[model samples]
Target: MTDDVPAQSLMLPVLLRPVISDLEKTDVAAAQTLRAALVKVENVHPGFTHDLVLGLVKKADLSINMNEALLRLQGQVADTDSEYRLRRAEEPFQELNRRSSLLKKILSRIPDEITDRRAFLDTIKEIASAIKKLLDVVNEIAGYIPGSTGKQALEQRKRDFVRYSKKFSTTLKEYFREGQPSAVFASALYLIHQTNLMIVTIKNKCE
Candidate 1:
């Protein structure tokens, strides 16, 4: 029994390693999918897409650095300690991973060309809904962290997302009534911008 307990305890960290690795992989894949979707939008709205794409690229770079930092931290921790923290945070990480996968799937629905207005509008609406779900998960994860600053930052992000979502809704309504593509495009860009910022905030504060 004694030998078995030691062996099982030693195996815990090894088992947990794949969970962190998988989360990191999911995050990277989601970022790539989102970037691709933005590029497709760029083809249609050249004037607005460039800045958002640039911002996303910068944030993605930061996310990579943060992931490296997390790996380094994991290595620094004692095996038992690492296992405990990983186990504690595992559920939030899994939830975040799940939401990110859903976001990627939704982003994939964005058409390559915005030629079909109804279709494009429907896709953005779905994207908006997915983003909201992601934000909710992020906010919940942030709540578990200790610092008030992190919580406050997440709150601000929530407020920003709400504002962007409202703009999207209003512009969507305008698009339906007057059929001005520009307004809808602008709102969509705002949502995308907010999403990138929220992602960066998640890395900065939550992770």
Candidate 2:
């Protein structure tokens, strides 16, 4: 019983960012509603937090792809409103975005059922898989654009994913099994943020 108690006592570190508190104190009054909603949930579930952060990462990626697709249509279509083959390329991002939203909703509903470390890690795998799929989709989309720069940008993002994938694997081995959930989660969070910033830079180049 004592041994079981020690295992049960293991807790995820309180490394969660002060997201709600910071929002309340800052001049970002526009986000007050979101802040309020978050505060209402006294104990923010880790799984929910994972989904939210991952959702934003996925959204940023899709936005980058959408922006690139629009750029591909540039000069191809008579105007933004005109029909073009490149415009159809945006359908995949739309589908991906819809899937991200659905994932968030489903995860939010299942947090109570996934507090086990193994289960949470499995969800992390899902997030990683989703990011990989997005990377592949971006590459496929770039194929139809047909430009050296476009191909180069996609290749760069692919390289970034590979780096992050390695980092994630290393962190998972070093921290997750050592009972350090915060380290593993933080590594994933940082990777997503970094990748999103990279994608944003690529999107800006499309302009």
Task: Using TM-score, give the best candidate's number.
Answer: 1
Highest lDDT scorer: 1
RMSD of each candidate relative to the true structure: 17.5, 16.1
TM-score of 1: 0.49
The C-alpha stretches of model 1 lying farther than 4 A from their native spots are 1-89, 104-125
lDDT of 2 by residue, 1-207 (tens): 112111111111111223443555775674566645543452554245434544675977743322122222221221221111122436664443433333322222223223476776676677567666656665555655457877676678668767866776787677645755444434443443334434444454442
Report the C-alpha lDDT of model 1 over 1-207, residue by residue, as the tens digit: 122221222222222334444554769776555546644564575534434433665977743322122222322332223212222356775566556545544443433324577787677777777777777787678767668887788779778878877876787677778866544444543453455455556666645
Residue pairs in candidate 2 whose N, alpha carbon or C atoms collide under 3 angstroms: none
**Clashes found in each candidate (C-alpha, N, C closer than 3 A):** 0, 0
Output the worst ten-in-a-row residue range by lDDT, candidate 1. Answer: 1-10
User: RMSD of model 2, in Å?
Assistant: 16.1
